[model samples]
Target: MDVPNKKTVLVIEDEIVLRDLIVKKLEEIGLGTLVADSAQEGEKLIKEKHPNLVLLDIMLPGGMNGFDLLERLKRDPILKSTPVIILTNLSTEDKTATEIGAIDYIIKSNISLDEVALKVKNHLQ
Candidate 1:
């Protein structure tokens, strides 16, 4: 059963270890989570679940990348307002990410799992 009023965060990442760590951190902080390995799956989850926030990775397995998904989200009338935080190893894409409509950009290597969880908590507020 779903927890009442629990905010769900969708993590779109291809790295299994990182994705699992992220989900674990978020869950430890009392948040619900949904995960996707590619942009297409992420988009599907966004449309269906309408999660409170999204933690997206830049490089994905599918043809569509995170930027592509971000653009699509920005263009969608209903989903445009959904908050997205770019969680990737790329430090160069921060400007492009924010300009493309992401609320924040996180460089995975530079941050700890605890910090990531804290950032997500702050964004959820």
Candidate 2:
């Protein structure tokens, strides 16, 4: 049975290596993880799991991108308050991401797995 109080983090990243690494790092600290390779899957998981936070990647394989998902989430009454962190290689989108309701934006190439874990921890607190 799933624990009622267990905190979960959803990672919406298409890169297999990065996604797996992030999952491992968060799991090491006892946080539950849900992963999606595209924005569509991310939306489904968010609706079903109601994760505490989401780490989103801008570039996805599906028709919808991370920005679109973020916009949708912000528009939804229930999910709008959920903290979302934009994790992508695009440094230029940081301002736009914040304008769209992302709590933080981290450049993938600039941060380590440990940093990722730390960011998630901070947000969860």
Candidate 3:
């Protein structure tokens, strides 16, 4: 049930290098991308763009963190269905992430950029 022109992924990360790498990788794979350096901006983008998926970082600079944003997204009727993948170095367990409604948890240090692209591809499919 792929909707025409409905492929976009929003990335919420504060790290410049990692965020750029992710944006590049996701774009190279042909998925549209939107980015936010903090959860507040991410929330705004999510409301405006309605991206198909989200790559969320646990720690953020603004008042709200990724976990808080995740909880809010899960509670929202419109956003609850969007797939979210936790992309962070935080020690938050996979169980916790899943319980919070994240589709997957990815450790930035453990996976290559291409591997991240692969995971995104799998989730998008």
lDDT of 2 by residue, 4-112 (tens): 6778999999999999999999989888888999999999989988999999999999699999999999999999998999998978999999999999989999999
Clashing residue pairs, candidate 3? none
**Alpha carbon lDDT at 30, candidate 3:** 88
Tens digit per residue, CA lDDT, model 3, 19-122: 99999998888888988999999999999889889999988897898889999999999989989999878655667888999999999878999999999999
Model 2 error, position 67 (Å)? 0.3
- Top model by TM-score, which number? 1
Runs of candidate 3 exceeding 4 Å displacement: 1-6
Residue 90 local lDDT, model 1:
79
lDDT of 1 by residue, 1-125 (tens): 12458999999999999999999999999999999999999999999999999999999987999999999999999999999999878789999999999999999999999999999999999
Could you tell me the lDDT of residue 53 within candidate 1?
95
Candidate 1, after superposition: displacement of residue 91 in Å? 1.1
Question: How does candidate 3 fare on TM-score?
Answer: 0.93
In candidate 3 the C-alpha lDDT for residue 107 amounts to 90
Ten contiguous residues with the weakest lDDT in model 3 = 1-10
